[model samples]
Target chain A: MITAMSDASAPPVPGFVESTFSPLVHAAVHRCLGVAPPGDGARTAIVLASTVGDATTLDTGSRSLVAGQAHQPLLFMQSTANAILGRLAVDLAVTGPLLSLSTAVPDDVAGELLTTGALLLETGEADRVVLVGVELAAGDRAAAAHRALGTVPPAEDLAVALLLDRDDPVPHLPELPAHPPPAAPPDGYGTLRGLVALAARNQGTPP
Target chain B: MRREVLLTGYGVRTAFGTGAEALRDGVFDGRPAFAPVTRFDTGPYRTDAAATHGPAVPLREVLAETAAAAVRMAGLPAGARADVLVGTAGDFTALTRFWRTRGRDADAGGAAGSDGAGGAGVVETVPAWQAAALADALGVRGTRLAFTSACVASAMAVVHGCLLISSGRADTVLCAGAYLVEEENLAKFGSGFALSRDGAVRPFCADRSGLLLGDGAAAVVLESADGARRRGARPLAALTGWGVAGDAHHVARPHPEGAGLAAAAGRALRGAGLPRVGYVNAHGTATRHNDPAETRGLRAVFGPYADSVPVSSTKSTTGHLLEAAGVVELVITLLALRDGVLPPTAGFTEPDPLCDLDFVPNRPHKADLRAAMTVNAAFGGVNTALVLERT
Candidate 1:
């Protein structure tokens, strides 16, 4: 069984969120596994999942620069939902296939994240794989409500990263619910919120 | 673990006429279908030549006409249900126009009553929604996907269709690509100096400066070999292999060294299980940058055989169809493989010394082609290659 979850946000320590989140999440997961963080050169795999990949930074930059130019908004390149994977790869120093997927459907997104994370561990693509789901809030009220309800959010920014391993302690929840998990949080805040919930759940002894 | 997927049927709409007969006649008789721009006012743009239609036809109508024709040719049941995959650069040219007009109206302080009813009013009018329209028209109840990968959209649609069949997700898939001329896109290309000046397209020619824009739709019915056999369907050609690669180098220009193009070609060849190829239907946009880059990439991959393999650019006749170019050229490639005839690269006169290859020029050539490859390189450094084998 694969088990690990953590959250990171952009509000506090925006610059170091990605770099710090991986090691922090790694430490939390290692604590649960009763192992130390692997040193450099140790084989580890990472699969980044995000709806607002590199496109976020590109969008911010484009919005900043569009005021001066009379050209088409380079919005096309600014919205790829895969930049987070590249950041995670750099942070974790992972040398493995980085798969990025975007699903508008919430339930499907959660299942896909778990399934992909499981595959990476099973296939030996990575010894310990990290699955990250990141999204930016759309500044819409309906989106925020959806994020809070674990359903399709109207639009919110959140990021949640989960570490999955083959030899990890399984969570002792009431039951593995048959119903699908709600869509992952929006890009920024939702990600951090979900990660917090994951970290809290993994804080105590493994059952 | 790739499975064999076949192109059991195809449909096409072009300026020459609709259906396979018209396309075949246009290809064989050396007919050019380019005419004055009718879809929009060309005064703001400098170009005079385009594959214009008599009147602006709704995309739904255009898709239905060609799709039904292809279904009839395939002899599938009228009520047949299959997966639907649509490829296009722009989903709704008319919708975009509508939005632009709405914007103008809002700016002029027109009453908001023209916005129509309900919050879902304008949202339902998007071109992306047309995929569902086509799916509904074909009575396809299985998976439906819309791909918009610039010029490589339709080719990717074909690739995805094959994947769907091989993965057993669907027994039959309708892979279609469409593009109707939009003023903004045309003006953008014209400003970029990519549009041809002579009101004609001349690919791989020494004097070739750029490409001429055209609008049309092409679709293919893909099915698993076992499924086709079970249905007693005769396949026109087999979709042997396909490869998609991103340049990650530039947004508009291809990799200066043709790295991504070569990689995509290698992947397609590997997928097809063929080390050498018989013919190549090149992207050959006729632009100074595209032609030479493609020629160099071909040489890098095919080596000595590159000089001998009869390569042609159908864009010379059809003009650059943007997203629809891949499917249109693909249909032509399938026709070539089936008929054992290599279509000519229409506009070649004096060959460029840099592009040293045997580009079957002026007229079609008869040959015993076992396999043919089609290449498409998009503006965003997205490159795709497809291999088709004679059935």
Candidate 2:
């Protein structure tokens, strides 16, 4: 008895560095977490999926140190994938089992995330689960890294959010945009653009 | 019908080396693995000490070696497919080296996915992709979910694995987690004052300073009891139940009274239908804040059983494995249940009044144990409790 709805194209979040990944994820989650009943957040779960999680912070911090400068603690703080989830828990007041995951393959990653959300509902681990997929859009550094590793580059700045519950009446979102897999497609291409395209296509539809 | 999850086969690659036997003997022998950090230069930090893996190893190789060992030990076919759930804290070395070399001059204000993208030639080391890489390296793939919840990452991964089995999604699931001691971890943890100044791990001791990071990966092959019996596999122990809770108290520090940890333990015990926990493998990080908070958690959940339960913090010997701590400790607990031996908490010289428990200090105790519990708490107030029983 699980129901799910998804959204992408969330506006940029305020009070966070614009170039970083955390704020974008926060904005996407901010819009979707409202679908969850208030005060029921204690039983609600938040699971964030990403391929390149806040690499900007890691880049900045490490570069600074290598340049003989002191590492910024703020960058280190945002380096963990769960940093955004922690803030969302406090802001949204949902405390149940906040988690973050990363994987290379996107097609099965989203499906697995949804399945895990369903399991949480089925096992009574949470009353509802909010699943979010985020991927780093290829920056100059990221693209070069992919080329160095001899892999296709990931799509830039893609994020998708879904709210799931058990046995609830809800409309299914439209399918993600179709794209043939690039030979040796880079990891996390599916969620980066594929998932966002799904949300954009389903924008005018009812859920 | 709800399925019962059983531990069929287990393997570990820790500072002590591969296999559960090596780990058990190392702990019982009271040998601590903490030594000088060798992965990279730690000259600027307070201490250059950690339990490290000596040589450089890629994530795929470690994943392949550990998973293959566990599968072989479980008596499962080498080609058998299983759901893969991995818990990790990212590749700090890869992340740092990539950024330092390729992204050294990355635009400070350029937005990710900006117009200036796709030719920057920077290498990326995202943690999320590790699960998929690991699955491919192991050549066995089912549903995959990677967990990155700090110290409790692997513990929660195990809990998720159990859920998948209980819900009949998969009969066999490989639940594993690993972390290698690296330069970035040492620098970051040291900056946050999370490491011991003296390069020693003394859990529950009066002079305890802080935790020492360790390098290790542990894997447990979990299957439905019926499936294990069908395959003629011996069950090492029953992964009876588990509980997960969040502190919501602070981002870095645990609750003063360990409210969330106690609740987690209570939930696991209730799910297992047990009135008392005979043994506890505590998440005793030997830090000033963690030791006392864990003590409060024990007092709150176990009550009268608190004084009676033989408690030990194996981290005293293994040095904290960080994300892999939960699975490693769980394997230790399973071994203890099977052998009727309570591993000792090494480095205990004087006890603190705040931590008043029967800590099996400095000496392994031979005792019959029917049920045992391993607890793990991470940054961001995440707490997990896993309960296992003798089969």
Candidate 3:
């Protein structure tokens, strides 16, 4: 069962730069984490999903290296999605398993995220899972990947965070992709549309 | 009860060569695969070498071969569809090609992202795309999960594959991963000053400098006991217990106490119902920060028993496989259990007082063993411990 959730537009995340990936994640997670019970962090697992991870940082960092300019090793560090997940784990004091997934499965982004969350509980790894699905607005290089993804690219960075508990498992959570969007502008948001609608439903807010 | 998972076959390719036998022979002999980087000119870099495949083969092709080998060895049917979980940083060879083709222009301060054709070619550089292509190459239509958790990616792949089977989500799971040294990671490791100046990874040594990279590609086929029996497949080993945890500490550096690693190992031992592991294939990157932390984690898990069991890092032989290191080491651990010979740490100069465990060093040591553990820690403070015992 989803206990809490939030969706975020592009927002400045403090201490992170260059790409909106972490910030978008931080914005959504920061809001949802507040709904978590105090001291519940130790049992909370963090799962991050993205099709193409921080290509902006990777592209810029490699370019800097080829040109022999001073490159921020920070770019290399942040390019991997786990870096921010690690930081968030530290910040939130969550000691459960930290994991990330990269896939462009055309359908069922939310279902995939939730299924992984269920697996964490099924494996006795965690009692609660924080699932975040993030996708960046397509750039020229990312556009082709997005086209293959069969989803209309959002014009801006998109992220949604959901907090799932093991008990009261949703039998048809896997069928969420076919459901209509919850009354928002993302009646058509491709990659993260299902996640956004789910979040809205859980939050008791009209999407 | 959860279903039992068995390892029927495995495939590995390193500088030592292809098959698990080749890996065992080379690593047990304390051979080093490190050579000068042959893929490109490393003149401008700090350390211009890693344990590469030498002749230059794409990492994807290597994965394909390893995957097919594991499947063939496991005696799976030609049309058998198995879930593929891989830990990779995508097709860096394509990235290398893109860099090589665009280097002249980009290095001259030309805008890098404007090349549409060049960028499209590298879409396979993403693990998802690479993984999808791998599944297609294997001619199976099944689920594929791509893990990108840095060093421990493939280890997590193995652990989760076990979970998928035990929970009745899958019957046969193909867990595979490979990471060949590339300029992007090399530049990153160099910038971080993590590479050993001497090019030798003397794990747990008092004067240990650091780790080097290598070409590590490996795959293993895991099947439920019932599934294997129905297929009349012989089991090579049993994947008894596994655990994964996060440090909740630093992102790039391990916790000084190896807090997460201890938790993972302890969880694994508990699940395996083995109070003591016969051998431990340590993550042992030979970095100043990693060894001591691993020592603490071992102590935390084993207590006095830590001194009894043998511990060693084959990274001293294979160099570091990065993301691929864990799965390759898992295969190494299996071979050790299969033969009951613990592979040496290879380049141990002297033991650091902080690392007081009995690291089977410099030479292979024979021991009658029941089970062994392979532990891998990644950049995100994520740690995974897998226990494999004889069936």
Candidate 4:
């Protein structure tokens, strides 16, 4: 049985400008783990849940010349649902086994992510696991949707990193949404985007 | 509890050429299938290395053809029953190309429908779809799943398939791994300085620089001892044990101390009920970091036996097949066991001092082997080990 979840964030550390969303999530994980910036010794399994990963990296030339260019679909290579684990590993020099999953429904994605993190803890795979959820709403489709809604953009980038420990205490928070919700179309990135939103909302941060 | 997982049949389509028989013959004759990349213009890519058979054949057709060949090699009846397990790093490269095309044309909807015709909705072609396509071609009716853990994908798929058989979920499981070199992979790895500069792969050698990327597919038919006996199939090898671990270290780079890899190998040996192994088919990518790290890990696990037991990396011939590396290497290990010979590590001239293990060099060595181990570490810090015993 796994039950503890704590979220943390960083104020955009310098010299880590590969991607805005990833570094923010990494900083949050580092803060939650209470280790140095990279935190390789956290002994944690990382599950990267995202809706749109690295969409900002797609070039305009590629987008105009190629159809899925805006999607930066090739960026999928760097964007596993659990890609943060890879990034953290590279940063922290970790070599632990990492697992990633993606689900279309927001509620189902959160539930499954939490359940899987708990399972990993229960199975003795890791004593603590880091769950990083990030979403970047800069893609063409997302921009078009924002324009159609005629609403001011809240935030374009959101990230949340939760440090889950089997023996840690749980924090009191607002009620979480219900599970077994309606299924959404399979986006390239999954519930990771929603996780970022949940994290920002929990922090009382807009976007 | 330990269960005996037998290799009832095996199939391979590789750069050394197609069909299991051809691969076996090439292995026996020291033939390598590596060649210059011709599938696409790799002008911007750093490494020009690949294991392609031809420029005209697409990866999907290659997958279907190899899967059919594997089924034929297994000699399963027309209506045989078996679960399907596929291990892959990514979905079809063709789908990526399709996405690039469809992303350009807003009028073109997403993935093509099941009918192979274009559809209006988003085209979702995942790794499972490829597995389903292979299943449909084989007329197999069983649970199908795709394991995608980068390099260890197919190894885990084989292990999971074995678990299904042991747990009585299916009598036989078809485990296959397929991956093709794409521009994205070439560019990303090249940009990271991951590929070799000389376009040559020299595993465990002092002059070894880095890995050379290649693409290919391999499959094996796994079954319980009872199932194989019932089918009267000649067993190729017995998959005795498997161990999986995550380094929790770095994604691309391995733990400097190789602690996670050591644990995985130890667990695999323990699962196999063996105190030591005869040979180790190493995951020697020949990179500046991997060869030494893997060597240290092997020494840590096998200790005194590390120097005596023959260890070699066949990737010198096939190049690093990435996700498909495990299955291809497993097939080679099985062949080694059957032939009573160890394949040599090609291009290994000067020995790396850090890597002191007995890497059967330039020429193959004939030896009687009872059990062998294959180790693979992937990009996500996922490490896996599979132990096979002579039947």
Model 4 lDDT per residue over B72-147, tens place: 7778887678877777543434434543544545456544322222111111224444555677778888755555
Give all candidates' CA lDDT scores.
0.61, 0.74, 0.81, 0.63
Lowest lDDT 10-residue stretch of candidate 3 chain A: A177-186
Of 3 and 4, the candidate ranking higher by lDDT: 3
Q: Best-fitting candidate, measured by DockQ?
A: 3
The two-chain DockQ for each candidate, comma-separated, is 0.08, 0.38, 0.57, 0.16
Runs with alpha carbons beyond 4 Å of true place in candidate 2? A1-19, A144-158, A167-173, A180-190, A193-207, B103-124
Residue B42 of model 2 has an lDDT of 76
Local error of candidate 1 at residue B117 (angstroms): 8.2
Alpha-carbon runs more than 4 Å astray in model 1: A1-207, B78-81, B90-92, B107-110, B113-128
Q: Tens digits of per-residue lDDT for model 1 on B314-373?
A: 877777887687888888888888888888888578988778888888888888989999
Chain A of candidate 2 scores what in TM-score?
A: 0.75
Error of 2 at B356 (Å): 1.8
Candidates' chain B TM-scores in the order shown: 0.93, 0.93, 0.96, 0.91
lDDT of 3 by residue, B262-329 (tens): 99999899989989899999999999989999999999899878889899999999999987988999
Highest lDDT: which candidate?
3
Model 2: how far residue B135 lies from native, Å: 2.5
Q: How big is the positional error of residue A2 in model 3, measured in Å on the Cα after superposition?
A: 4.9
**Which docking band does candidate 3 fall into?**
medium
Q: Which 10 consecutive residues of model 4 chain A have the lowest summed lDDT?
A: A145-154
